[model samples]
Target chain A: MSRMILLTEGMSNPEEAKTATGLLRYRGEEVAAVFDSACIGETAQDVFGVGGAIPFVDSLDGLEADTLVMGIATAGGELPGAWRDIIADALRSGMKILNGLHTFISDDPEFASLAAEHGGELIDVRRPPAGLVVSSNEARNTPCFRVHTVGHDCGVGKMLTALELTTAVRGRGHTAEFLATGQTGIMITGSGIPIDAVVSDFVAGAAEQLVLENRDKEFLFIEGQGSLVHPLYSGVTLSLLHGCAPQAMVMGYDPTRTTIRHSAKPMPPIAEVIGLYEAMANVMAPSRVVAVAANTASLQESAARELLVSLGESLGLPATDVVRFGCEPIVDAVLEERRRVGEGAED
Target chain B: MSRMILLTEGMSNPEEAKTATGLLRYRGEEVAAVFDSACIGETAQDVFGVGGAIPFVDSLDGLEADTLVMGIATAGGELPGAWRDIIADALRSGMKILNGLHTFISDDPEFASLAAEHGGELIDVRRPPAGLVVSSNEARNTPCFRVHTVGHDCGVGKMLTALELTTAVRGRGHTAEFLATGQTGIMITGSGIPIDAVVSDFVAGAAEQLVLENRDKEFLFIEGQGSLVHPLYSGVTLSLLHGCAPQAMVMGYDPTRTTIRHSAKPMPPIAEVIGLYEAMANVMAPSRVVAVAANTASLQESAARELLVSLGESLGLPATDVVRFGCEPIVDAVLEERRRVGEGAED
Candidate 1:
């Protein structure tokens, strides 16, 4: 197995260093250390309260790793200019780079030449495959029960919820596959179409291709991208919704976020947001939000549990913070929805 | 103005030769002839019943033109391989090529080398500008009365409706600017963002940029893209819808068709479609579809007028073929909607 060092640098916050946290949480066995100058000498447990005993190193001077993973998600996925020297050093030392940013490292002349000279490989996980046609809604013809995890906004745990739900579903002895739509999710899952990196006209096609590719799976927990109300990304959100043609949906929301971050638009009531999602999905097929994955990270355990109970009662659906409480409740709701819709029924 | 020859080739039919027809209809002064071997001796009038008597030629050998325009809008914007030799010939002879396809002509190695070798320029109208960030709802601050032309399906006269409405509004002594969202519109108007060619994350940003750039115009008729019900391109539709954040919308539909052309989904009732558009728009701000621009190309004069009248009455909005009748009814309804909503009202 290749030893990996995650490069998060200035992004130590869990939300900012999502890619780093995700790999540490799910693929911990492969991660040797994290490279964050500010969090040097600290462990992942000290910084994120998880990834037990994984040490943080300031530089490659003493680290033993063959692969470097980009561990921060930038706003527009542009590579930070400050990291050039470190990345060049890594490439010069023959360490492969796994990049999830929109900026393809393989396409950069300097990086390409350095990697070619050093026998180092550059894998751009966000580079979408070519010749993707428009979606023909072929996913609808598949026999799999698709459960898409939509969100109230970007970075609200949609991917995490989907991953957890996939685990829960598979634990129940059902074959479930997690479909990744974003960079972090793609890295965790090993393969996925970077929906946001695709051309605007083929966003749905990419989502549909993911579903069709895993048609043999009994259940598909599709990781959704932006919110329906998100000012900039609603198009991606809607495209994924229609392309996946989910039989059921899990609404992911960060309760602490009252409005979409970085935009002037205020978040509508959760019930209303659910309605909007259902309405958009119904335009393609009959789909409903069967549960809610509440991100109650800001609250204490007791408060989070209490809020989940009341929220579930109000919305008349199962609600839980998959991190605090296991994904059983949400998975149970999805199973119930599948049964109600007649498991793998074609409409 | 440079003398131009439209390269429609085998796409002699008006629908297939939309770029050729659009240029001939709107910018006839620059067009010298059309290069469609299939319709060698025919004129634009014989082929499209419009554009006076611009003759079609079998080849570019004797054509006196300084520029060649790719005149077919292929599915997925791909350039037909059969047309490569002719395009190369045009480039070799030092003629500028105006391309609207998703395939950027200048990016092709051979075409790029040829254009560089010869004194010829290649303009890819669909190539999006760089550095587009997520939208922050900056367009809502613009004081212009934005009229967005939405559609029931792709190729349903959305762009033409916006162009016609702009002319009608200008004829009424109002300073109206047409915002192009597609290649044909970009070719016709000389400048506008190609919304679909952009990255999925920045579709709305591109739309927002167009509105903010043209904010000084008193009236803005923003051309729409694919339908909200269109399986392949709905994301582009929604992004354009939310990006423009129009005060009023004109519903463009082809009454002769009852379903989204290439998909299995049937078209919903026009009223419901309008409601969907309004509800999606209202998520950002108050907006409504005030009129209908019916495409009655398949129907005869009286039958088309009869359908338009009934369609308008049934939907309770001003409807016209725009091509057959004129944009007066739709423009009047838009003016009424603006008055009711309080012109240039900042909500």
Candidate 2:
């Protein structure tokens, strides 16, 4: 059994971690131990279900593991002293370290040096495949993708918009999945766990599950929060993509509003959404592309077109190669249709 | 006993909410009900003693209370249809709705209209006092004026910075009290909860106890989470402040960081910290000021000086009027000196 230790700065979400653990267990990888900065004593024991020590020594004991999974902090922040020590120990033990949060260590000379010395890689999951080709038939066959939706009470529109885009992708034969990041009935504060933590755990969990299920798929969709002000969704999406290193193309949607709320108001300006996509596209550089504009005014469509053109030009792909779909009943309707098809196939 | 219903958004920290509840209880007000949007039935029952139901009722039907206190969401984004209905209903009831997250409502006009039509006032707690003045003696006496020492673990710097400032204000013979906005120790998605939540809760909790025990002062110090990256903190803070309206002054701090982890290395640039303080000072316009710099680095001191100068210039106060103190060793030194003074006085 291959052993893997997951080191997370205490700033992550627990539910995501549980999902990751479940995914790892399903993947047939022995998760040796999980270390969090905040879990200590009885709570740590209860949570980790192992020796209830403050600094759980699983990562430090030079345990034989094929991979040391390190949760990425959102920005350019240094690891806790304890984390630094554990990473140093893991490096000394010749362990292969995989870091999900790239921006955090990108500027740090010491971390970069350590990565070089230990043959560790800082992955940027947000980036799309290089020189990847997507056939229209392939798009039609596997027209959907999966994403985790996160937001406050009324911010469901963020997810709804992503679902709409998923439908359009499937219209070309691709599928999309919408995974709820936080559970229902949890207060915003209670559920107010950071999005990066949720994304990290979800990506890891999803990857593990996918590997276990032996589901050959390409492309993972991520839906950001409606409010542009909060960077959790973006940050986490980047980190998750980095950690998972998925083979398929990865994509994300930016809502129209700077602030995402669950309400009846129209979505944000198309320009803003397009700008977000452009920025993310520049950062990630996905190979094949599909974008759907939902609940958007006609004016927004022009902006979306311009954005797709710019993205295609930058990626050296023709503008027509990037599929752009309308918002009218594309996501919800197509998803329903796919369900019906699946049901019919089952029958 | 007057009945008060406090309605808050879900993402609030439970410990902070409990502290606020204690403060309200000390004020001779009976909390009839408390509602948090993120809270599940079980947790809500545990925190507010309300079983599996939304805490606030917009209509006064079957409710006997002259004074009804409800926390309103001020953060602008879309609200759920149900949430809008709740807010609209609450306003129509002619109840005194306290705007907890003042920042959210101040930025949006629709909320202002709702408050106006519903007979509620959009209270701006960050607004400058009618006649703001800071005496050196008062600065020396108030908890807000005092120096504070805290650790990096659990967002101690931000939490204590806010708490110490609030405490300094109270020490100046003002009727000061501190109220925390949310709870602590919730796990969703990621690795685990960060230490900052715990530290903030502890500091706020301690401050609340002190304020309740000494209520003869004229000013109140309401401590809330400084980090607004999470909406729940903003929501809960807004609601709590609304409940304690007509407060003489509301004190908070502005700390800058690049990452979400509690223990990130490489503190924010001095310029960024200065920018944050300048922005916050413009927003807060505190009357008297004592700026304490953590003895983390010389650059931090320089940043504090820059912040003080900018703040004083904006407020038309002398730069020297903004007294600067080093937080390291102050708490321990103060306690030791106080013990010696008491012993000598007794002898």
Candidate 3:
């Protein structure tokens, strides 16, 4: 196993360091340390309070790790200029670099040459696989109960909800697979198509391929990307919805966010957003927003609990933060939806 | 202007040679001849009954042209394997190749090395421009009267409708611009973002940039892509819809296409497809499919006329085959819609 040192730089919050936090949460045993200048003396547990006492360092000065993972995604996935020197230093010392940004480090002349000289590998998790065509609705042939985790924004625990739901479904004695569509999910699960990195025409095709490959699994918790109402990424969101053709959807949302991130566009009402997704999904297959996966990390435990109950009652569906309260309610909803629709009913 | 020989080897009909037909229709003067082994003795006029009298030849034998354009898009935009020797031979003679396929000819090792050694240029029209980020609704700020030509399927004359509408709007003394989104449109109008070629996240962003750059025009007719119900390319369709955020839409459709091309998916009712486009478009902006630009090519002139009138009354929208009749009715509907919404009204 590779001893991974996460390079999160100035990121201290779980929200900002999604990939890092996810790796720490699920693949914690493999993580050696986190390198963040802002949270140097702290550990992963101290910062996000999940990953057990994994130390944080100001630099790679004394860290001994074989792999250096770029542990955060910036708005447009561009490599921050400040990160270049840190990455170069690590690459010179023969450390493999794992990146999940839109910018491929392997394509960078400087980084590529240095890594080549040191016999170090550069793994770009977001680089799409070759030969992807436009989706042909081949996913509809899969006999699994596919449930997608959709959301109101980019980082509202869609992946986390899917991941937790996968675990919860398996605990119920069913074969469940977490279908990763983003970088963090790919990192945790070992393989998944980076949906956003694919050519626009092939986004749906990529999603379809994922479902078909894992057709034997009894259930698939397909990870979602972008909000349907998000100004920039709504296209990707819609493509994934049609491509996956999930029979049931778990709506993920950060209860605190009222506007789209990085823009002044006010969020549409939750019901409206859910309707948008359902209507879009029905374009390809019959589907419904079966439950809500609320990311309530911003709220106190009591408030979060209160919000979950109220949200459930208002939406008339079970709602919960999978990370805080477990994903049992959502899994129950998925299984219930499947039963209501009949086992693998074509209609 | 560079003399061009259209390489449409097996394509003898207009439907199979969209790019060649489009180029012939708009840039016929620059086209020297067409190379289609299947229609060697025929001319463009004899085969398609258009483009005057440009002759079709079997091979590059004795052809004197500076540019060779790959003139057909195969299913999935793939280059047919049989065309390899033709393209390679053309490159050997130092001819510039303009291709518009998902497979980049410039990236093919053999093609790339051949072009490099022979001082030839390979222009991949589908190659997306660099540095596109997620859309931020910057297009909403532009004051131009934006109209998009959406469709029920691919190759159903969305580009033709947009082009003709631009001409009609220009004929009415309005400054109208045809915003290209595909390779044929790009080749016709000189520039455009290949929306499908872009990264999934940047499809809308690219569309936004195109509108922003041409904000000075009084009227902008944006070319559309795949149908909202198209299994393969709906993602591109929806992304383009949201990205352009048109004030009104001219829906392009073939009167005979009862199913999505190449798939078993039944085409939904015209009203339902329109509603789907309207609902998805309204997610970003209040847009409506104001007219139907039907490609009634399969019908006789009289039958086509009757279908157009019936379609118009049934849908309660102006309908016409822009190529057969003028785009006067569609252009009039666009102007009427602009008036109904008021000039650049935000609310």
Candidate 4:
């Protein structure tokens, strides 16, 4: 198995360093260590709490690994100039590099030549195929029970909810697969087109292709991105919603969020968000919001459970902290939607 | 000025050949002739009951022109295999090619080299810049009066409304420039990006860039893309809506339409669609539906007037068919929004 070193230098929090935290929390086996000079001596447990101990390094100088993953997932997906020298040194040292940035390192003539000489591959996770077109509309006709996670805002547990729901379905003796659609999700899954990196027209097409390609799976859990209510990121979100044509959807949101991300306005109520998502979905196909998965990480265990129960009652759907409560409610909805879609297909 | 030939072969109808119809109707000066083997001897007037005669050719042979323009803007933007031979022969003969396809012809090494040798260019009108990211949020702060045209469905007069509104504003001694966001609009203007070709994350960013680029113009008439009610292209529509941070929006719709394009469900009512669009606009910035622009093509003149008057009275906003009747009502609303924004800026 290939081991990887995470480079998260200069990132202040785990959210900014999601690539490292995602691997630490999800795919711990592949992660050898994280390199962040500011928090040199701290372990993953100290930084993110739930994870087991993982070594941290000060710099890239002495780190030797099969792959050096870019653990600092920046907002704009640009390769930082500050990381240029460190990355070039790693490339020269014969370690394959992996990135999810919109900028493909292979497209850089200098880096392309450097990687060629060292015989180390540059894996761009978000670099779409050169000739990708708009959605083919075949996913609209797909029989798979697609359950996508939509959120109130960015960084609101959409990915985690989808992953948990996938696991919950699998544990129930059904074949399930998670569709990764963003950088962090792509990093954790080791496959997916970073949707934000794709040209706008092909975003939905790429998603449809991903869904259509995994037809054998009984349940498809699609990891969502951004918010439909968010101005900057809604294009990608709407594209994903239309692409998969999911019959059921999970509204993933974090508690203590009162507004759209990066703004001061109050967040729309869950019902409104649900209505918008379902309306948008219905525009493409018949769909409904079957459940809500709240991220209770910021709340106490007792408080989280109480809020979840109340939210479930208020929204008229099962709501829970998927991580802490194992996503039983979401899974039940998934099974139900699967049975419904299964019947529709037979007819 | 470089004269261009339109290529609209085997498209069956005028709507399917919008690129040809738009240019023939609007930008007649730049258009030399049209190449459609099926309608070789027919004029634009013969086919669409509009515009004057322009020669239509049967094949690519014996044609001498500076550029060969793609006139059949197909759904999904795929360059058909039918156009392959004609395009290739033109490229070899040193005619620059203009395409609105999602697939970039320049990316083809064979066609690229042939064009290079022949000193001709393959211009992809819908091609967006490579490194575009999310919006910088500056458009939100810009003092310009941003007005965007939205629609109930595609082919319902969004581009026409914006163009007419810009003219109306100009006629009133105000400066307004149209921002073309589609292939037909781009060809009509000889400049403008097809917004759908952009990366999803950058759709709004590009719109912001386009808006910011034309700061001298007091009123920005943004040509809309797909309808938000249409499942397939709603992402682009939403992106445009959020990107410009419009102070005013015009609802462009065909009166006869009752459902989404290529969809079976009856379309949401005008008030409901208006609420949705305004709600989305409010998420980014305080904005509202200023007026309505109806396409009364299928109705008689008297019926069109009755419907327009009723829609205006009920919606409590001015409504008109910008094509048949000039865009005075819509222009008045745009000017009003401009005045409001201008007053706010002064304070």
lDDT of 2 by residue, A226-327 (tens): 222122122233322222222232223333444332222244443343443333222222222223332222236778667656644554332221124545
DockQ of each: 0.73, 0.01, 0.66, 0.60
After superposing candidate 4, which stretches have Cα over 4 Å from the reference?
A61-64, A336-347, B60-64, B263-266, B339-347
Cα lDDT tens digits, model 3, B176-290, are 8999999999998889988999999889989999999999998999999988888778888888888899999998888788778867878888888898888778878889899
lDDT per residue for candidate 1 within A66-130, as digits (tens), equals: 99999987666778888899899999999999999878899899999999999999999999988
> Top DockQ: which candidate number?
1
Of the pair 2 and 4, which is ahead by lDDT? Answer: 4
Q: A1-347 in candidate 3: lDDT tens per residue? A: 98999999877676668889889989999999998888877878989777888998877777779999999866677777889999999998999999999999999999999999999989999999988988878887678889999998888889988888888888999999999999989988899999998998889999999999998998998999988787778888888988998999999988888888767777788988898888778878889999998988789999999999999998899998888898888888899998988655853
Tens-digit per-residue lDDT, B249-334, candidate 2: 22222334344222222343433333322322221122222232232222367786676567445643322211145332233333
What stretches of model 2 exceed 4 Å from their correct place? Answer: A1-156, A167-176, A182-217, A223-347, B1-156, B181-347
Predicted structure with the largest TM-score when compared to the true one: 3
State each candidate's clash count: 0, 85, 0, 5
Binned by DockQ into CAPRI classes (incorrect, acceptable, medium, high), candidate 2 is incorrect
**In model 2 chain B, which range of ten residues has the least summed lDDT?**
B184-193
Q: After superposition, how far is residue A240 of candidate 1 from its true place, in Å?
A: 1.6
Candidate 1, residues B1-347, lDDT tens digits: the string is 88999988887776678888888888988999988888877788899776778998877887789999999886677888889999999999999999999888988999999999998999999999878877768887788889999987888888889999899899999898999999999998889998898989888888999999999988999999988888788888998888889988999988867777777788888888888888899877789999998888889889998998898789888888888888898888988887888744753
Which DockQ value does candidate 1 get? Answer: 0.73
Interface residue Cα RMSD of candidate 4 after superposition? 1.8
